[model samples]
Target: MADIKLSGIRKSYGSSEVLHGIDIDVKDGEFVVFVGPSGCGKSTLLRLIAGLETISDGELQIAGQKVNDLTPSQRKIAMVFQSYALYPHMTVYQNMAFGLTLGKKGPLGGLLGGGENKKMIEEKVHKAAASLKLEPLLKRYPRELSGGQRQRVAIGRAIVRDPNVFLFDEPLSNLDAALRVNTRLEIARLHQELEATIIYVTHDQVEAMTLADKIVVLNDGYVAQCGTPLELYHQPANKFVAGFIGSPSMNFLEATVTDIGPEDIEVVLSSGKVKVRLPVLPGDLALDARVSIGIRPEHLQEGSGEVFRMSSRVKVVEQLGEASYLYLENGEDDPFCNEPFCVKTNGHSSIRTGDSVDICAALSAVHVFNASGIALTRTTTDSRYIAPRRA
Candidate 1:
C-alpha cells in the first residue's frame, strides 16, 4: 500500500491538450475515483498515472518516488482495463501466474532453478483466486467462464503482482447491468480485504459515489471538484458539478436577484410566478442581477407549503416502482426550455401526462448559481419565509 500524488499533471496529443494542470492526492489504502462525462479526459489521466501514457508536463509520484520516465512495468502499479484482456488459450491459473512467472528471478537470478519459483507463483495465484472466489474456476479457460468470472480473473491477475497502486479504467463498462452491480460489490470487498491504494476511472457517477473515499470530478480536461461523495452531492462548488453529480440531474431555472440581505438573497424566477429567498451569501450581487436556481429532483416535493413553489404542466411520468419521476415542460419563452424540469414523487402518484402540478422545495435544498455559473456560498440557517400564493 502506497500513497500516490499528482502535481499539476498535464497531458497533450500533438498541440491539443487533454488534461490541464490536475493535482490530486491519494493516501495509502484509499479508494479514489475519477468521474466525469465522456471526453472528460478521466481515462487519459488514469493512463498517465499507470505510466501507460507519458505525462506532457507536471510530476507524478507513487510511494514518494518521481516516476515520470519510468515504464509501465517499472511503476509497480497494476491496471484492469474495460476489456478483460485475458488469454483465451490459457486456463485461469496460468493466466494469473503468467506475470509472476516471467519476472521470477529468485535471489541469484534463476540459480535456484524453477521448482521453488513455481511453488511461490502457485501460492500467490491460489491466494488471489480464493479472495475473488475464482478458486473453483482455476482450470477453466476464458471461453468457459461467464463475463463476470472473466473480469474477476483479470483482477486476480493484477492482485498477484502485489502492486503499489491499482488502476481500474472503467472495469465495469463491459458488464451487464446486474453483473456490473455484483462486480462493483466484489471490487469494494476486494479493496477492503487488500487495503490497496486504488485509483478508478469511470463515467458512471453511481460507481464513483458508492466506491470512492474521494471523487475527482473532471470537466473538459480540468478538475471541476474533488471531495467525498456526499460533499459533491450536497455542496457542489459550481453549477456544472451541481448538475453532473446527481442521478436525475438538478433542474435549473433562470432568475434575477430581487433583494439582498446580509446573510441571504432573494430571487424571482423569469416566469414572474415565484420568488425564493435562498440562504446564500449575497456577495456583490446587485438587484436585477441574473442568476440561476438549481433544485434536485428528489428535493422538489409534490404539492405546496415549502418556502419555494412552482406550478408547471407535466409532460411525462415514469413509474419506477419505488418512485416516479415527473418531467415537467418549461414553456417556450423560458430560457431553460431545452431542459426538462423533473420532480421525483412517490410511485403511487396518480399524476399523469399533461397534468398541472404544484411543486415546492425548502430553501435549504435550493442551490444558487451566479451568471458566471459559479455557485454562491450557501449559509446554513433555519429561517424560512412563506411566499404569497399566486391567485
Candidate 2:
C-alpha cells in the first residue's frame, strides 16, 4: 500500500493551463476517485501522478518519495486504460508475463542468468490469473475473450507487477450495463483482497459515489469539492457541486431574501406567488437580495411534513418502476431555466401532464446559495428534518 500526496499540483500545455494549483492527500490503501465533466482536468491529474504527463509546477510524493522526475516504471505504478491496450498476438499468460520478462532483460541486451527468474515469473502469472478467475483461459488469445474478460486480463497484468499504486482510467466504460455491474463488483472485491492504494478517474458520478472512499470533484480545472459522497450530496460547497452530484440534478429556483431570522430565512420566489422559509444561516443576507434555492427531486414530497408547500403545474410525468419524475412548468421568460426543476414521486403517482399538484419540500432538504453561488450553511431546527441521509 502507498500514500499519494499532491501539493499545489499544476499542469500546463504551452500558454494554456489545464490544472490550476490543486492539493490532495490520499492515505494508504484508500480508494480515491477523480470525478468531473470532460475537460475538467481529471484525466490530466491522474496522468501527472502516473508519470505519463509532466507536472508544470507543484510537488507529487508517492510512498514518502518525490518522484516527479521518475519514469512510470521507476514509480512502480500500474495503469489500466479505457482501451484494453492488449496485444492480440499474445495469449493471456504471455501478456501477463510480458512485463516481467522484459524487466529481466535489464538495461543491457542480456537476459537474467538463472532459471529461477523464469520460475518466479511463472508463479506470479499463475497467482494473478487464479485471483482474477482467468486460470482456465490462460492459453487463450485476446480475440477469444469477451470485453469484460479482456478487462480482467488487463487488471491481472497490473496485479502481477505488485505496484505500490493502481491507476484506473474509466476501466469499465467499454462494458455493457450488466457487465459493468459485475466488473465493478469484481474490482470492489479486488480492492478488499489487495488493500492497494488506488486512484481512479471517471466522469460518471454513479461510479464515484459507489466505489470511492473519497471523491474529488473537479470543475473547470479546479477542485470544486472533495469529500465523501454523502458530504457532497448533503452539504455542497457551491452551486456547481450541489447541482452536479445528484441524479436528475437539484431543482434551482430564483428567490429574493425578504426576512432574515436567527435560525430561518424567508424568501419570495421570482414567480411572486411562492414564499418559503428555509433553515439556512443568515449570513449577510439582506432584504431584496437575490439568492437561489436548491432542493433534490426525492426530497420534494406530495404531502407536507415540516415542509414548504407550493402549487405547481405538471408539464410532464415519466414513470420508472419505483418512481416517477414530475416536470413542473413555472412561469418564466425562458422555459429552459426551469428545466432542472422537477420532483420525484412514488411509482404509483396518479398525477399527469397539465394537472395541478401541490408539492412540499422538507425544510431541511432545501439548500440556499447566495448571489455569488456560495452555499450557506443550513441550520438544523428539527432532528427529523435534517439533511437527507445516504442509504
Candidate 3:
C-alpha cells in the first residue's frame, strides 16, 4: 500500500473558494475518513485526491511521488461512489474483469501471451469475488442482484484493479439501514485483510467514528480538528467539533464564572440553582464572565449526583430499545435562547412526560467553553469516558 499526503491544498470554482489550505497525512495502510456537515467541502476534497478535480493550490503526493499533473489512472487510486455504477447487461465476472482488459493491444502486449493474460485476469477476478463473498453471484447480472450484492460487486471491481489507494464517497448512503450496517462491517473486514490505504468521505458521524483510524473534521472549507475518534469525542478543540462528533449532540447551558482556582474554575448556571467546579485551566477567565457548559446526554443521570443538579419538567420521552432520551424543558425565561435539556436513561425508566425530574452530572463530565465557542483545556486525567481503541 502507499501513503498519501496533502499539504496546503486549496480548491476554487471561479471566484469562490471551497477547500482552503487543508493539510492531512494518511500513512501506509491507514484508513482516514473526512467527516463534516453538508456543504463542508468533504466530497470536493475527496474528488481532488482522486484526480477528478484540479487543485487550485498546494501539493499532493502518493507513494513519495508528486502527482499534481498526473491523470486519475496514473494516480493509482480506485474510487467507489455512492451509486453502484454497474453495467446492467454485463455479469459480475465481466464487470470486474473490464478494468484488466482496458487498452489491451493484440496478443495482450506483454511477456504473458493472450491465453496466459486471460487466465491471470480470471484468477484476479475470482480472488476478489471470493473475498467479497460475491462468488455465488458472479454469473448474475446487476439487475438480478440485491442492492448490497450490487455494491459488493462494485467494491470487487475496484479490488481487481489492485490500486495503491481507495476512495469511498458515501458508499453506503443508498442502502437501507440494515444493509448499511452489514456493508459497513464488510468494508471494515476488507480493510483488515487488504490493509490498503483508504480515504473516505461521509456526513454521518456514526460511520466516521466506527470505521476511521483517524478522523479529520471539516467545517466551512476549513479543517476544524484532526484526531482519533475518541480524541475528537472526548477532547474537541472547539464547540463545533464537540457538537458535530457526537450523537444526540452536546447540550450547551449558559453560565457565568463564579470563582477561579489553581486547577479548576467554578461556574454558576443562568438559573442560579446549579453551580459546578470544572477541571479546566482558568486562562484569562475573570469572575462574572459569561461562558457555556457542555454536557453529553449520556453523562446526565436521573436524581442527584456528586457535582451539579438541575430540576426540569420532562417535555418528551423517546423510548429506545436499550435507552431512553428525556427531553426536558429549559427553565430559562426566554425559550428562543435555549434548547430542551436532554438526558439518556435506562430503557425501563419509569419517568413519563410532564413529570418533574432531577438530573445530575459529575464535574469531570462537564466541558467548559469560552464565549467564542472555543473549548478550554481540561485538567482532568480520567480516561474512563474516552472511547476504547479499535482492535
Model 2 has a clash total of 0
Best by lDDT: 1
- TM-scores, one per candidate: 0.93, 0.94, 0.93
lDDT of 3 by residue, 158-245 (tens): 9999999999999999999999999999999999999999899999999999999999999999999999999999988899998898
Please identify model 1 stretches exceeding 4 Å from their true place.
104-116, 333-337, 381-391
Clashing pairs in 1: none
RMSD of each: 5.1, 2.5, 2.8
Candidate 2: segments with Cα more than 4 A from true spot: 103-116, 332-337, 381-391
For 1-391, candidate 1 gives per-residue lDDT tens digits of 7899999999999999999999999999999999999999999999999998899999999989999999987999999989989988999999998778757565676455443377889899999999999999999999999889989999999999999999999999999999999999999999999999999999999999999989999999999999888878888889999999988999998899999999999888887778778899988888999998898999888999887888888989999999999999877654344689899999999999999899999888898999999888887653331112223
Report the error of model 1 at residue 320, Å.
0.6
> Relative to the unseen true structure, what is the C-alpha lDDT of residue 182 in candidate 2, on a scale of 0 to 100?
93
Off by over 4 Å in 3: 103-116, 331-337, 386-391
Candidate ordering by lDDT (highest first): 1, 3, 2
The digit string of per-residue lDDT tens for model 2 on 1-391 reads 7899999999999999999999999999999999999999999999999999999999999999999999998999999989988888999999998788766445455364332288889999999999999999999999999999999999999999999999999999999999999999899999999999999999989999899988999998899999888788888899999988989899888889999998789998787777878889888888899999888898888865645777767888999969999998865542224554689999999998998877887778889999999998998655543435545
